[model samples]
Target: MSMLGTKWKLHGNGKTIRPGHVVAPEERLAWPLTIGIGMQHVVAMFGATFLVPIITGMPPATTLLFSGIGTLLFLVITKGRVPSYLGSSFAFIAPILASQQQFGVPGALGGVVLAGVVLALVGAVVQKFGAEWINRTMPPIVTGAIVALIGLNLAPAAKANFDKAPVTALATLVTIILVSVLFRGILGRLSILAGVVVGYFTAMARGEVDYSKMDAASWIGLPHFQTPEFHLGVVGLFVPVVLVLVAENVGHVKSVAAMTGRNLDDVSGRALMADGVATVLAGFGGGSGTTTYAENIGVMAATKVYSTAAYWVAGIFAILLSFSPKFGELIATVPAGVLGGAATMLYGMIGVLGVKIWVQNKVNFSNPINLTTAAVALIIGIADYTWTIGELKFTGIALGSAAALVVYHGMKGLARWRGTVAEPETETAGLPPAVKSAMNSAAKRSGKKP
Candidate 1:
């Protein structure tokens, strides 16, 4: 393989591939087919990537530009061993809003840069040592608490947007639900995007969309760019995001490894470092923080093509698209109602994912440490608790994340002191109906047996 693995031989004469066979990362189809797949990658990533900037009041073109750049950077840093596309991270939504209030967008960017540096450092540590310590530090219970709380805390914001145009939001949500059920495979996976499109049309019908801002944008021009400013105050808002990024990257590596039937544990650290660097680049260049996008993963899963060559084409396409300010402006025209509709499902899904993590890991609620850790954190997060010191402040997500870690560790240590820890029960019958419902709902959405 070459340095960036840009050299790829033909995969089966660049024609139809047999079932149960896939084009490896180092192999690609003929020029036209590969280009088509690459464009498909762009469409797959379009909705979720643009939503981050639209929601956070950042320039959509700028974010797209960095995403393209980040994907290329990831390929280079990982030495093309891993196949992934970088996109804006949803974990930054709440924190960016919080930091923007006090320190503005630049301040939020500062936090992003710092978080990337921290993640990169963790990656270096993992590369030198191993990833076992990460599991020890953030066990399933603790990680679940943090992830769930972050989502639950955003409920109020979702409601606020939903209130802006309740009818439109409702229609959007309904469309999303229907689309997921009506279509199978790739379309079902893209329910969010489908819903957004339906909602946009709904908003238009309601005469709520404003088209004036888009007229000024040119077809060919540079995207709006801004510089990050240092802000020690918002550091707390973004550091927890590094953990989420770590989980996402690790999961990406694991997923690719599973599909490719390759041992990717060796490059896990490099994967993390690559995403960290991508995020750092985004922060400095006025874009949302980047992460390995599941949307792209979904695309690869459907096509059974794990070609890095396709991703290279996708990156170039994204860069070219970013140069068109008119497209960026068009994206920005999405109404709050549509965003609210998407967020309602998206945020809840994030929370449920945490619960899924618990279920998958068989995290024992019967255990006091696990129960207390989750209970306290959920309340603090759902209630939107706040704590302020002389100059530092902690809101729901920050406070909840900290509480989960401290409570889990404190109770575990005390249990050890008293020798009270015991085996966890694996019975699903003991779970609450709400939990079971949520889990089943999630299972259906992911196309797995519930």
Candidate 2:
């Protein structure tokens, strides 16, 4: 038999069976092993699990419960094709908080739920128009700007937390830095976890840690599932926020595909669908919008483990933890100072990622229009404290993102009209094998063989 068709023989003439068939090496992991590594992903994303609730004024335990259930639903919807753990995204924090303060929690939740639906709509668009269309509409420059806005908008929250107890926050920050700098192996990989642990102990030593809540917590029971209430005013407030989540979902799809060496369709179409749908489910279950967790990507990158099944394991763990009031209390008890120090790193990383995207895309700086678009966008995004348009008010990072998208696209359009920038070419459609063969034959006949 040819090598291509051959199977290995073992035990003195019999071929031994190969382990994996169609699945990626990592994808074929057993349930136990998958769960083991999956738990690591959960741990990595734990901080952000309840952060959405805290920021948006929803109950923290309810958020945690839905996060777990939403993740599992996401996996089921995706048919377990992608190995991503879903969690509350930081991108919505600014808008949700603003909406909550302006409208109320129900209104914010409505917006978040609407955001999930928007993501689902984006997925349909991706299916119909194809990835190239998405690539064209929201190029690297646009995404970078949005990502920059996401981080910059979050600056106030981090600063507010840090200012509450600068000394304690600094101590936590020091611990995080020390672990990141000095640790190795699992210790280094879990530097965030270690920092939280160390900071918790340090605060305890200083008699600053509060354990009063732990005593009030029950030993076991399900989360308080909430029924959503509808309001037009709340829904309207969240509409823009939903639009932003759609952009974030696109980024998540891109990030997973880049990290996993898979095409977006090949990697996780169903998964993306699940991410959106599960988020809707989460909202109904009294939670916020869910997206693929970026922190878990860090764990996978470090361990070089890419098993989709591992996320299922993490999902199960999350579900169990959700029902445990003590677990909820523990997660809730993490000091804001600890969160602040980490946020300094986490939020800044978002900005740095934006810079990376901008630099790598080689954004056309030579063109005055390009320069103006980028400069204005950055200025508006980073320092947007006020704007009023004939009565309607707009400010902060959302304004910045909206401005960047409009300005960049408008400039590009103007440049096209003036014949300064060439018109964009349509991406080539798929070519079947027979068509390829026919084209090749015609080319050979014309002495232009390829």
Candidate 3:
């Protein structure tokens, strides 16, 4: 029961996952199946993680290595209570570039390190103060909108992939749907991974999978690395990103809580500090700042498996893979079309998970404050609004999350000042122990530990 403990008791039967049952963070499945799901998560986070470094003109290998390291670090810090994958954050891109001109790449990385320290400090505050105030400020409606907008904000990224090879994208998307419907047990749970396999081969047939890099890549090599050089000027450019990262981490906690029907609010601070620590490590060795990846969260939503053990596998495997250029190149061969199809499904799932938060919490949209909060925030996020002040940039998720809080509190406060009826909020119940009943049944039948 240790919050930071690594042990994951086996889930029911460790083979078949019955309907209405999800694998919890502290539980695990058979090694083979867990390994597959873990690999699926790696594939899920790969594209976006590498893109940050690639776009910022930093070495992609360095980012991958740190991200993998960060993922494992996050799992440990959260004490296995929360399941998440740490990946390169898009929020860092603009600021890192801005800092690059003034402070150079090393200094930009230093800013990342400092930002992580600030984030960790924020986590420490939440840890000391408790996270209830976070909930007070952001109720179900606001949190739900925050999660929904993050997913919707990536719609264009999905569409861009869809456009690359419509036929291939459709095939991949269709396969994901059909596999879930046609199969049960492990295959059903692995539908996304299955779709990826089918799509890869399908793309190969269409001459979309490029094998050139795979052939040229070496079997083993070290990912490029560099140390940070501190610069105070870079702070202005990067620290603002902490706001977006906080919103994302909080949204992730809420989403997981909603999906698992459990109250994960307790781990909010630890999750934040974990990312901060992970990012600090990334900065030390020239990697992109990390955040909990929505892409991997989408995979969990699809799989119904939230085992932190799988993340351990994914993280360790990523570290191993970072040294292999051939493997990196091979993943790159996965065409935009395959990614497009996956993005379409994964991103949309995340958006809906936000709405699910509303449904589960019974957020009364009939209240004008609630309705407007969702309305304004969703539009800002889905439209991918962008605003810049000096060297700082704020984009969809950051803006949308901020918008939800402002719109909700602003309207609610104004109504209260006017002595208007402030609508009452529905309470969120503690999530049922989703795996508990099944575990009891299996243990009773087998005379084993529950």
Q: Give every collision pair in model 1.
A: none
TM-score of 1: 0.93
**Model 2 / residue 407 / CA error / Å:** 0.3
Q: Write model 2 residue lDDT over 219-315, tens digit each, in one string.
A: 7987766665555544433444544455555666666666767776643345545667877777777777777776776677666665556666777
lDDT by residue for model 1 over 364-383, one digit each (tens)? 68666789999999899889
Query: Which prediction has the highest lDDT against the true structure?
Result: 1
Backbone clash numbers for all candidates listed: 0, 5, 3
Please report how far candidate 2 places residue 64 from its true position, in Å.
Answer: 2.4
Q: Least accurate stretch of 10 residues (summed lDDT) in model 3? A: 422-431
Per-residue lDDT of model 3, residues 1-450, tens digit only: 466657788889999888889998888899999999999888878756765665466777778889999999998898888889999887676567656767689988998999899999888888889867766766789878876776677778779878999989999899989997998754565566677778889999999987986898898998768899986566555665676677689878888888888887778899999999999999999889999987788878888999998999999988998898776666567788887787788678768877998997788664577788999999987886877777555666667778888988887666656645333344223436555455444534543223
Q: After superposition, how far is residue 297 of candidate 1 from its true place, in Å?
A: 1.2
Candidate No. with top TM-score: 1
The TM-score measured for candidate 2 stands at 0.80
Q: Estimate candidate 3's alpha-carbon lDDT, on a 0 to 1 scale.
A: 0.79
Off by over 4 Å in 1: 425-450
